[model samples]
Structure formats: C-alpha cells, structure tokens
Target: MITQRQILGTGAAVLAATLTVAGCSDSGEQSGGDAGGSASIVVSTFPFGVEEFTQAVLDPFTEATGIEVEIDTGSNADRLSQLSLADGSNGVDVMLISDTYAGMGEEEGLFQPVTAADVPTMDEIAPFAVSEQYSGPAYSYQLNGTMYNTDELTAEEAASWDLYANADYAGRLALPDISVTAGQLMVSGVAASVGSGPYDVDAAFATLGEWAPNILQFYSSTTEMTNLLTQGEIVAGDALNGFATELVAAGEPIAWTAPAQGRYMATNRAMIPVGAENVEGATKFIDFLLGVEAQQASAEIVGDLPVNLGIEFPQEIIDVVGDIAQDPTGAGYETLDPREIVPNRDVWVERFAREVVGG
Candidate 1:
C-alpha cells in the first residue's frame, strides 16, 4: 500500500543514515575505517555487463570505503551450484543472484541471514525488496510481460493473454521455454487467469497445452527471443520487460506491455555466503548497493528497476516501463514465493515440458 510519493518522501532520512554507515564522505577519506583499512571481498555476479556494473557500483564503493572487491561472474544456477559443492569454502563473500536461486541456497544452508541491522539501507527499499523468505534483500527486479512487434499488433491486443492463442497469429508467436524465468511467470499468469491462483498447475497446463500449436518456438534464451522478434520471425512473446528495452530504443517496431491481469515480477538479491571471509565488508557493500546513488546508476546503466524507492529513474528507464517502476505492487505485479517455488520446481519444469510444450 506504499505509494511512490510516500516512498520518495521517506528516502531523505534513510539516505542520510546509509551514507553514515557506508563510509562515504565529501573529503574522499574513509569515514568508517572498520570496513575500510584494506578489507576485501569477492563478489559473484551475473556475467554480462561486468564493465558497466563495476563502473556504476563496485568502483564507487571501493573508492568510498576502501574495500577491495574481486569480481567473480557466472550464471545464477552455476554460481549457486558451486557454492553448494564448496560447502561454505566457495570463497565467495557476497553473491548478487536472482531470488529463486537465493531461496535454493537458503534452503541448503549455503547463505546466512542478512538483517536490517547488518545493512541499514534495507529499511529504505520497497517492502517487497526485503525478503521474508530468503536470506538476502532484493536489489533490483524484472517484470514479466508481453513483447511484441508494434507493426503487427495493437497495444491493447498485446496487453491480454489471449494474444498467444489467437488463431490469426498462429505459427508466428514465441513463448519462453519452461526452463527459463519468463516461462515460469507465464505459467503462473495463465494459472491465475484460468484457475484459482498462481500455483494452480492443472489449469495452467491445460490452457497452455491448447495454445501450444499456435506457438512457433519455445525460446530458452534472450538471444533467441530477440532474434526472432528482430527478423520478424515471431510477432510476439512472453518475456521480461528488459528484453524489449534495447530493441525499442533502437527504433525497432517493437513494444512491451504488462498483461492486463495476473502480472508477476522476479528480483535479483544481494546475499552473503555462510562462511564469507569478510562479513563486515560484504555488509558494507550491500548497504552501498541499496543506497540511492548506486540504485540510480544501476537503473541507468544496467536497465534494472531500482528497489530503492528514492531513485528518480533515468529517461531511458521511464520510456521502457513508464510509472510502473514507481509502485509495482500498486500496479498489480506480484513476486512468487520462493518457498513454494523451490520445492516444486523440478516437477513443474518436467510437467511443463511434457504437458504444455510437448503437446
């Protein structure tokens, strides 16, 4: 129920507290020497955009706090698996991963709890960013929606789930494969639309199975979906909103629209491993990442929707999502509970392949 105005208004005091703890100062001297003074941490993050991320977040943090940051990058699943296999000796101090993977790590005891006491900035982010189900907090989020060829469909048509099943668009539409993030969101959206709620698999599969014949491809990667859309091979697909940002900006005849019903979002979290070598450094890094300046830089460079409510988004971000970023929950977007998702993930993926895509 928090409005954008309220969130923005509350940020001034929060940012002041965050700056004190983060060791940032106008004199370019490390104010909080405990986390500075030659402390170091290894940060595991998504492989893409390393340069941009380092410039926007890591470099600034090191400059402000004198914490040495070593970069480690991989896919979410790969990094999580490594952490599990290492049994707390992964040497990873902090991990920036998706919420789903963070939940899995929490269940496996690979990560330790990160409370607001450890990261004061946690109190400033949107409520959803503070996880009740994981060991970390969400730093940024992605919304699931429809990305379509603007020349082929009206915005109204793209905003409805029915577009996937329309006979007129058969053989020219793509849907994310169940193995991917968008695929799971699409399933839940269908479930909510046709059955009792987001977890109603029976209703979701039944509806998706019927629509299968109309879909040209079950895409598993961003490249596949973007290529299909760019070449005019597919008219539309269910995808995360970020997928359409670049294409739309380049003057491609493409657009993204949030579905009229059953909207869902996914988050990227900042988690500390169970045996992190430098917990204090990790905590400081997380606090800095959640601060207003870092959040705004990330939104502009990484194309992520900032969880820091105080951030005034860049024009590029606004053009892609409009005011939805201001208050996702108010706009009807929901994030799936990882507790429910973790236990049933394998079964859901198997069934989706067999009953939905296999049909």
Candidate 2:
C-alpha cells in the first residue's frame, strides 16, 4: 500500500482557486500551439497506480518523437492537493486523475482544453470517456464491485453488497479502504439503497452504522486488503478489480458484480489548468492519450475499459478478461450511470465518512 507521506512530492504553488475574471468569456476557441523542437512534460498520477499505463501510453510517444516524460505518483489526496495548487500554474504539464478525484479538479479549473479532434482515434472510444463539458475521460472502469471468495461463499451468496450486511453474514465481512473511489461507492450503495436519491446523507449513514460491525477493517491500502483476503482475514464485500482480477485470473474461485444500486464507474481524465503556461504541450498529450494505439495499449495494460474511440484491439484484448455478472435482483446493477450523481459527490463523501466510516 502506498502511503500519502511517501508519495506526495514537494510542489511549486501556482494560483489558488481565488482567481476571478472581470468578464467571464469563452476560452475563445481552444488555444492552439504547434510542436516546436523536442521537450519533456511532467504527468502526475495516483500512487501505486498503473505504471503500465505509462509504459502502454507514454513509451510509444517517446518512440515516435524523441520527447521525454517524467511522472509524479502519489495518493488520491496528494494528487488532488498538487493539482489544486497547480490550477493556474503550468508547473505541471499533464495530470491524470480518477473520476472520483476529477470532480474537484474539474470544479476548481485544474484542466486545460483537450485537442480531442486532433486525435484520429477519438471516434472509437466509449461515449462516457469524453468529459461532460470541459476535459474528457482518459479511460474509465466500473471499478466498484463485489468479488467474493468461492471457497468461503458460493456465487449465490456473493451476488451483491447487501449480503454482507445480512443478519446471517453479520460480523464476518470486510470492506476496502475508505479513501478510494470504489470503496466509497460500495459503502455509498448501502446508503442509496434505502434513500430517496443517490445523495441522501440520511440513508447512507444509517446503512453504514448498521453494516459497520460486520466489517473487520476499513483497509487503508489495496495490498492490505489483498493480504487480508489471502490470509482469510475478511471474506468479502467490495474492492477494485485489479486485485480481484489478479486472483480470479489466477483461478482463485471468486464471484463478482456491480450492483445497480449505484455502482461507481470511475474515469481518469486529462485536465488543463485554467491558467497553464504550457497549454500546447498539455493539449498535445491529451490528444496523444486519445489516439488509437494509446487506447489499445492503455486498455491492455490497465485492465479497464478504454475511453478513446479509435484504438481497435485484437479479439484477444477484448475477450481476455470478461466482465462481472450482475445480479438480476440487485438494484438494476447493469446500467448504473455515475455522472448523474456527481453533483452530490461532496454530500455523499461526507455522508460516507460519517456513517460508513463511523466518524
């Protein structure tokens, strides 16, 4: 597990969120810049994140053009703080943040215009991969879901998150770290299940208060959760697919699902600071990310759905790892859309921290 202390690097402070414009006008047809000679760019990403993303997406850029790149990896909090500080400063070239983390950055203007049109593969990526109005989703995943140990529980019992909270299974379940997006969603599902809407704080905390004891620990890191699963510490509730995929791919018996009761579909995005200095480079990287080869490579390495429309993968890539099966009675788990709930993010987070985290 990557700790925030070891991950956050010293950063240069740029513009805080206090910049105000005399007259707010359109960014005036996305700013454009041509590639001059060769240059390097800095990309900040999540800690213990996918280096394979860089290898799959960045390496080819370097190979094609002699430009070099460097990365600063940290926890979700570290990246958010750094991105907030870099809001108007071009000190950081490009930043990749998860869908859960993207909201704050998107609201704070931490991103620049993406030259999506320049990327030939733009049409091939999934529709949700594109940002709503400002930045676009780099790549995304339905990361929030349940993967139960087959030896301990049968497929019938591992179908949804609610099972862990059932009276029969009480005191034997465990949940993922509260700090991440998927974990929050798994916990949030409990709230939304009994509420009027996705953001109902009243419903979320009530559910957590009830489910809390059944959970052994709110793991702070994926590695810890992995160890817990391996050692039989916690049977299951929810987790990110990477850990689950590895086990399932290895033939460890497991059952998985993304409950329709509002499972999270996490997206990584490319944002340009509102007042960035190297806008040209940032946009270029964004386009590079959306290109065909980049999409193919990124999806292959990271094991998530590719957002870029252009990359056509061989059947091997598409069929390599199949998706999780959804439960028919588990809150319409197949078609949950996360964007609709963005407006309630802060409220949801607070509600989870209070009721679910037992704060």
Candidate 3:
C-alpha cells in the first residue's frame, strides 16, 4: 500500500515548478517543441497530483505516440477563466476538468464537440462518462459517501443517511459545506433520500436544517474533516471516497460506504478547447487517457476511479472501494446532470448557507 507521505511528497514540488515555468508561454502557442515531427499539445490539468498523473498518463503517452505534452495547472475556476479570456487562442489542446466546469465551458462555446469518431475509446467507457451533456468524455469519477471511524461504527451503521441525524452520534458528525464538490453530492443524496429526487433542494435543505445542530461542523475543506476524524473530534462525516482511502490504507480505522438510499458521483473529463492547435493530437491524447492501460495506471498511481469498463482495478483500490470499482452504476451510483447543477448553483449555495448550515 502507498503511504500518505509517499503519495503526497513524491516529485509534486518539482512538477509544480516545471508547470509554472511552462505555463508562462504566450497564448495560442504550444509550450514545447515538436518531437520527431509529431504534434505538440498543451494539456491543462488540475494542480495537485501532477507527478503521479505525469508518470501514469503523460510520459507513457509521449513515449508511445511521440506527441510532446506541455502542462498547465490550476484550480478549475482559475484555469477555465484563463481559457475564456484567451477566447479561442488558449493554446490548450486538451483540458482535463471536472464535469461542472466542462459543462460551463460547453455552454460558453469554449470547447469543440468530441465523438467516438474522434476518440474510439469513447465506446469502451461507461455510458455516463460519454454523456451528450458535455463536449468531452469523463476520464475518471468520484463517489460521495460516508466516512466513519471503524472503532466507533459498523459498516451497516455508517451506510445510512440517517446516521447524520442520529441522536446517539449528535455533535460528533460532520457534513461538507455546500460550496465544495462533496457538498453538492451530499445535498443531492439527502434530496434523493427524503424527497422526490436528487434535485429536490427543498426537501434536502429542510432535512439538513433539522439536523444542523447535530452536526459538529459544516466543513469547507477535506483537511478540516479528515483532521476531525483523525483526532476523534468527529466519528464520521459525509466525504468523497478518496478522502477515506488513504487514511484507511494508513491503518487509521477509517471506512467509507455508499449510503443505502441515495448515491451520487462526480466526474473529471478530458475536453478539447475550441481553436486547439492540434485537434488530432488532442483526440489521440484523450483516447490514450480512456484506454485500459492508462486507466489502470491512473487508478493505481493517481488514485482516480477509472471510467473505462475494461479496467481491472489494482488491489489498493479494491482494498478501499471493494466491488464498487467494478461497476459503479450497478452498485447504485449515478452522476447528477450538469444542466440541473450549473444554473442553480449560486441560489443553492446561498440557501444552503441561510437555511441548512446557518438555520
């Protein structure tokens, strides 16, 4: 098993420095020189886990296809803002972004539509991963679930959404704030459990409001929630499955479970921006990312849950998610529609603060 320190410390700083320097190149220009007459494409990606991602996906891709890759990394909002400001001249050939931001970009016409004709691997990934809602396909996904201290709770006890409101655990549980990714999932989960469906914010907020006093905190960051769990300040919290995996691997007595009633997931997609200089190379890179080998490596190294149906997850992942990694949809996980999310995001955030967290 990979230790937390090893996963967090390895080559990340150097990779960040390299990306910072590379990202300074002018808009509409490829940051790296062409390699052996092969196309050079700039890939905009998340800032964290740079080293693992490069090793798992980028370097091997360059080795195989001779397509030089230049990386640009930042938070989703910041990077998407940059791409928008650049108009069609962002010079980013491929964008690895969360589904929400991808949907926003698609609505703004910042990305070009991609199909199986452009990336054959699209046919092999999960159907939800290639939804017509976005121009690109999901390369990876995340499940929202409850994380609990095994010493304090059983898997059966933690699997219910009612755990948050249980008087026995009052003032010893946490829930994500409505601003983060996990927050949205929790809201949708609660909505699905107590109301009509995932988008039933009225039912979700009312239920959460009633349970607010029981919650130790409405945590805004993963670090805060994880620290609370580790210090035994809180026994359990609603969090992304990734947050619990490392802690569980480190023998922290942490365990995560998909809630018995409502389950939702978020995805990260591989998108091609409009005016991408190397469209063919972009398609090729995305194809490689969705391929079985690349998906497996990403799951093992970068800890992303693969979207490719053919991927046989590594033992480390199995140790964490068990059989859910095999078939997420069959296991009762569903992705929330981005169209339902993007437009109402602000209103929901405000209401969540006023009614659920604050009330």
Query: Which one wins on lDDT?
Result: 3
Q: For model 3, what is the C-alpha lDDT against the true structure? A: 0.84
Instruction: After the best TM-score superposition of candidate 2, give how far the Cα of residue 177 lies from its true spot, in angstroms.
Output: 5.0
Q: State candidate 3's TM-score.
A: 0.91
Question: Model 3 misses residue 331 by how many Å?
Answer: 1.1
Looking at candidate 1, the ten consecutive residues that score lowest on lDDT are 1-10
Candidates, ranked, TM-score: 3, 1, 2
- Superposed by TM-score, candidate 1 places the C-alpha of residue 237 at a distance from the truth, in angstroms, of 0.5
Model 1 regions lying over 4 Å from their true place: 1-38
Q: Model 1, residue 142: displacement in angstroms?
A: 0.1
Measured against the true structure, the TM-scores of the candidates, in listed sequence, are 0.89, 0.77, 0.91
lDDT of 3 at 145: 92
Query: Which of 2 and 3 is the better model by TM-score?
Result: 3
Ranking by lDDT: 3, 1, 2
Higher-ranked by lDDT: 2 or 3 = 3
Using TM-score as the measure, which candidate wins? Answer: 3
Candidate 2 or 1, higher TM-score: 1
The parts of candidate 2 lying over 4 Å away from their true place are 1-38, 49-51, 309-353
Note each model's CA RMSD in angstroms.
9.9, 8.2, 5.0
